[model samples]
Target: MQHKTIADTMNLTIDFNDIDDGQFADVIEKIRAERRALLKATQEKYAKSRAQKALIEQQKQRLRVQLQCLYGAVVLIMLSLGWVFSNLEGTTPSLDEPGITHRTIEMTRDHRLDGIQLSQVERYFTAKFLVGDWRFRGANVEGNGITIHIEMPQPLSLEPHYQREYIRNSLCPKGDSELWLSVEPANLTIHLYSDHPSRGQSALCAS
Candidate 1:
């Protein structure tokens, strides 16, 4: 008859009624083998788990680095675009008013602008300073004279002498002959005429 009892590591059947001293050694050996096998399995399983955890951590770290790089690249691109747009915006105004701007006036002061440009500048100044809807017809360069032809609307609003002073002082450049503001009553057109005479004309006195 055999009896069943719990051993150290595993279940084994042995005779308890008549104890076999010879078989006891075999049972002990079997239990020792079972413990050794269990230990090896546990150690292998723990080592595999640790390796898996380390690999997962490494993967997570690499993913974090990749995300950071991508974010940095996007920010850099945005900054570059902002700088480019800012410069482009700085170059020109977004809106233009009817009259000449301060920037245009500054351009006229520069001597580099040619004669034709200066005539145009005169038209701009005329529109800005004096009242009325004055249309610039064209500018003429005669022998020593320069005439700015303009179409004025209706009976002269401002004093004719006021226009003459403006033409002599502001419109005319160096070596001017204030030929005067001549008007064609039939067409409501006016001419701001000036000339570089044989004898040089004096500049207007500063007020």
Candidate 2:
């Protein structure tokens, strides 16, 4: 069967042979008017559908932007939390040691002295005690540095045993007696251990 417009259907249903020429023309014009109305209705429907699709697309784009911003903020918060926890975990608290303690050299590798010679150091002590007419000799230098073996003319309080500590503890380089000294006495001979060398002519101890 062939497709027919409203004009063709109406012409087939009406008895045009019985109608006058003027009436036939009037019926044809009425069919043409219906065709124009149908075309306009179809165009209006298409325009409404196109506008709906554009509105939907705009809404979808706004939703995508909102999701992107939410994701970025969540990522930033996670990074900030990680950094705070890491710093908290790595931190340590400190405690103090009790007493009025002096600083000590724990590592002896660099204990060797370059500022002064052992011979020059000996002369400093020898000349210092000459007022007491106490004789001084270099005798020997201990294995490394910071110690010397000396012989005096008298016992100089070299009593039996531990009493030597009292004398040594009280000793220091001449002008700076607050500096530490230790003595090992055997008769008139004493082994003086210090942070060694001295002030004045010797550059070891402070002035």
- C-alpha root-mean-square deviation, each candidate: 16.5, 22.9
Clashes of each: 0, 0
- For residues 1-207, what per-residue lDDT tens digits would candidate 1 score against the true structure? 343323422444444456577877766676677678778999999999999999999999999999999999999999999888644432221123222345443442332222333344345445653765655544332222333444445433446577656555654432332222221111111253222122212223221
Best by TM-score: 1
Q: In candidate 2, what are the lDDT values of residues 26-83, reduced to their tens digit?
A: 6677678778888899999999999999999999999999999999999999999987
After TM-score superposition, the amount by which residue 44's alpha carbon in candidate 2 deviates from its true location, in angstroms, is: 1.3
The numbered model that scores best in lDDT is 1
Candidate 1, residue 67: lDDT: 100
State residue 143's C-alpha deviation in candidate 2, in Å.
37
